[model samples]
Structure formats: C-alpha cells, structure tokens
Target: MSRMWLCAVSLAILCALSLPTFGQTFSRILFDTDMESDCDDAACLAMLHALADRGEIELLGTMISAKFPWSGPCADAINTYYGRPDLPIGVPKGKAGIQQGSKYAEQVAKQFPHDCPLYDDAPDATRLYRQLLAAQPDGSVTILTVGDLTNLRYLIESEADEISPLTGQQLVKKKVAHWVCMGSRYPADLDPGKWGNFKPDAESTVKAIEAWPTKITFTGGGKFAELISTGKRLKELPQDNPVRRVYELYFGGNVKDRHSADQIAVMVAARGTGHPWKLVTQGHNHIFPNGTHQWEVETDNPRHQYISALADGVDPQEVIDSFNELMLHQPK
Candidate 1:
C-alpha cells in the first residue's frame, strides 16, 4: 500500500481503539460505609472494587459514616489498593469521636502499601458529596449507603451552597439516578431488634428516608442474610491483601463463613437484578422514627423498592455463593 494509504489505515485503527469498548456505559458509584465496626463493610468495599475492575461500575468516591479515626483510612487504603489512590474520601464527625477499633484499618493504613493521607485528613461528607455531585452529569450517580444516615441526612437537608447551586433535594432529584441502601427490615413482621442501621442515628434515618426524592432500593436485613462465607477462601490469597487480613481479624481464623449485608448492597448495585436475584416492587418500605422498619404494600409510595429472594430462578444459597466468589478475588 502507498504511504498515505497506510497512514490512513493506522489512523482508523487508532480511532476505533480509542472508542468505548462496549455500547454500555458504566454506572457511577459513590460508596458510603460504616467500616469502623464490622468486617462485612470491608468485604463490601472489596467486592465493589472488583466490580469496578470488571468495568461493571465506576467507583467515584467513598464517604465514611463511621466517625472513628480509622474509617477514612480504611476506605482510602482499600481504594488505593485497587489502584485508585486519588479517590476522594469524606468523613462524618458526630459525638462519637474515635470510638472505633477496626481490626484492620490501622494495620492496612500503616503496613499495607497505600497512599490515603491521614485517617481523619479528609473532607466532610456533605461538602464532598456536593463537590462530587456537582461534577457529575445529571441523572448519572448511584449512591450505596451501608451505614448510618448521618452523612446522607446532612446531604438531604443541605441548601444551595458553594459546591453547587442546587439544593440537596433538588440535587438528588436532578443528578442522582437512584440509591441502594443497606438498612431497614422487610416483611413488617420481623422483630424490631433485628434492625441496626436506624437507631444509632434515628432522626437522620427518618429525615433522609422521608426526604429523598429519587428511587431507592433498600437491601434490608431479611433478604441478604444468607451472604455468609468462611473467609478461608479469601485468606489463602495473600497476606498483603487488606481484605484477607480483614477476614482473619474478624473471624479469628474460624473456618465458618459470616453473614454480611453490605456485600448484598454492593452486589445489587453493580450487577442489578435478573441474574437469578430480582427486586420486589409490590410495595414500599416504611421507616419509623425509632429506626424500625416495616414494608407495607401501599400503592401510594412507588418511588421505593426492596430486594427479595423469592424470584423464580433465584436460589438464595447460590446467590450467596456467587457473591462470596466475587469477594475471594484478590484486589487488583
């Protein structure tokens, strides 16, 4: 071929390579977790990063609802381990300061190879939310809250400020597509004591739940209860892996798997329904002030939905196994 023709062919190939590999656009994700207390939250973060590596989702940033000193560091360390060292970190400061003793946060932050600044050296949750939201295209963000409603409540109640010209409610309606939260109890018949996310900050839960305008998928306690597994599979991977260390710390070398709710939230958010698991839109979830929840089949509320294990093709145990498999992959 002539030199000109060869140049044209090379240019064409380069342009094709530069184009998106698939027609599907990845979902933008903002992870909110209370990683200070439970290793399940750490597991959830690992799964989310794995999904991001698969191009199934885009992990935009992380907001720590757990105010303990280690919360931000743990989130940053995990994100950094996934090769995203610059991921934004946000922390919420309540009266509960430094009450956290994460089994692996300090360890990961100090010993592991990561670059998350200081533990508490991060932006406030609302400010970071506003900054990130303002930068995103309209109707493009999906938030996953597997922790207290403290940050979310502040974001919901915030008015127009320096971050963006839109109010919190308006911003959510305009910018956020939906949110998948790990809280509440479904079926309305379960004992209130079964729920946990509501109480630590009941007022925030009520305000945020009542005010959010976009669609919400609540991954409550009942449906995802079966996502348990012995971290043995994950532990054998690598000692440098934060997730491996987390499992070791939480389980103390036990061979039995432990139930984790946050993993379900992340799983549903990334690969959403129909792969055996599906959502039940029959009714909406009701949030009480005392942090207890009941799912009432009310035609009045259509903007909310909850996860269920009753789908035709779904085997709860199989779903749990698949999620566990995702968790076992070493962080890239």
Candidate 2:
C-alpha cells in the first residue's frame, strides 16, 4: 500500500479503538439506600438485581443510609436471594442520618438467609465509598441514592486514607460519571419538611449536593411516580421471594400497590429516560435549609437534571407495568 494510504488506515484504526464498545455500555452502580423505612427500597433492590441478571448493569455494592439495625441485613438478605450474597453492604456510622424503624426490614432480615446480621457490623458507608471508588476506572461508576444523602455527604467530606491518596471529592470526581438521587419534589416542594429523604437529613442533603463534583439528577416519587402504584403483583411471586414478603409485610399482609418513587429512580439510573420518561437537564436543583427543594431552570445550567413527565401519547400503565414486571422478576 502507498504511504498515504497506510497513514489513513492507521488513523481510522485509532478512531475505531477510541470509540466506546458494548462492554462500556453497562453502568457500574454503587447503590445507596435508606432501607427499612419504605418497601419501595426493597422493590428497587430487587429490580436492580434483576437488571444485573440481564447484564444491563453491574452492582458494585449496597449502602444502608438508615440507622435501624435490620436495614443492613435486610439489604443483604435481598442481595443474597438474588444470588449476589457476596456483594458488599455498608451502613452509616455517622451522626447525621435517619434512624427510623421499618415495617418490613426486620421481618425480611429475620426470615431470609443473609450473612450481615447487624447494621453496625457492616462497614461504614463513607469508607466503603472511598474503597469502591478508588478501585473503579475513572468516570465509570454511577452513584445511585434512593434514600437520605447522608452517606454521600460523608463521602464528599471524607479525607485521604489508606484506600487512596485522593480526597473524597477528588475520588468522586475521578471515578463517578454522575449521581442519581431519588429525593425532593418536582418543581418545588412548597411544604418545607414534606420529603422524608431530604427533611430528615436536610443538612446532609445540602452539603452533598453543593459539593458534588459531577452532574446530579434529582428524581422524586411525586407527580408521575405517585401515579404509578406497584407491588400488588408481588402476590404472584413465590412465597420464598424476599421482595414479595417485603411488600406483604409493608401492607400488613395486604400486599397492595403503593406509590413508586424509589423504583422509578432505579429505572432511571439503570436505563436512561425514554421508557416513557424524559429528563429536564436545563435546570439546577436548589435545596432549602428546611430540606424542601426546587428546580430553577437556567439556559446555561448543565450540571443538574430532574425526572419529568411521560412522553406524549405514552400510557401511564406502561411505566406501571414495567415496574411491576421488574419487581416480580424471578431471581437468576
């Protein structure tokens, strides 16, 4: 071949090598949740594990933001049931966090098979975040929070340790692609203390969001999420399914459908919008001192996004069906 032709071929090969391959399509998620407060968290975990089974995503670890003793074990039990028994589980050891008891966490932990017996026995979420992030390739992990932002706040404020030389903020900026938070009401929450995730640890929410170095997407259970009640179909799953038991216990044995805030957030994290949903990426999220938040649209704003309404002509049931199907998914 002529020298000019050989140069052109070499350049084409380099471009092809630089392009993303199918292996890079799957998201590596570090899931953080305030388990035990709501059955939706359980549903979210089950859905995520199912997605992992389908090879759409890889779950790096699960962190419990709730202080309840059973929260860690409940998460572990669900992870175990999904055949990921070895997945690392972390719990917040800091003072700023939620400590509420759950309607199902204790029961699920007691009835299911798991290795994490106590919340305190698990590693600190901040430390785990550092270690997990330090080990991942830069800009390859997605930090998905479906509960309080307490752990994230702790992670951002953490100092250099034996895990890595970089500080918490630096490590996050280096490793995390973006953060998907399932908190706050859409547009604005006129009621300052209404949202559980933000209100209980409002200070942490402010600290985490303010200092976060990457793009942040805030998703909520209000609006479209409230319209998508789910888990009623859990009755169809075998009694051995821990998530099914979670729904039953949460409803006092009724197993009725419930609003899906965290579940929707999980869907958005795993599969980017357009499963009948879209993202409003032009605004920034403004969190108040009292924990309520609002989205202010700015043409130049590019770091924040909020889950918006369904695409035109899309039926609400389509989302409902999708959530229910994932929740009812059989463990692989």
Models 1 onward score TM values of 0.85, 0.91
lDDT of 2 by residue, 242-290 (tens): 9999989988887888889998888877876544676787778888887
Number of the top TM-score candidate: 2
| Alpha-carbon RMSD of each model | 4.5, 4.6
Off by over 4 Å in 1: 1-25, 94-101, 117-120, 189-192, 227-230
Best by lDDT: 2
> In model 2, where do residues sit more than 4 Å from their true spots?
1-24, 298-300
lDDT value for model 1: 0.75
Q: What TM-score would you give candidate 2 relative to the actual structure?
A: 0.91
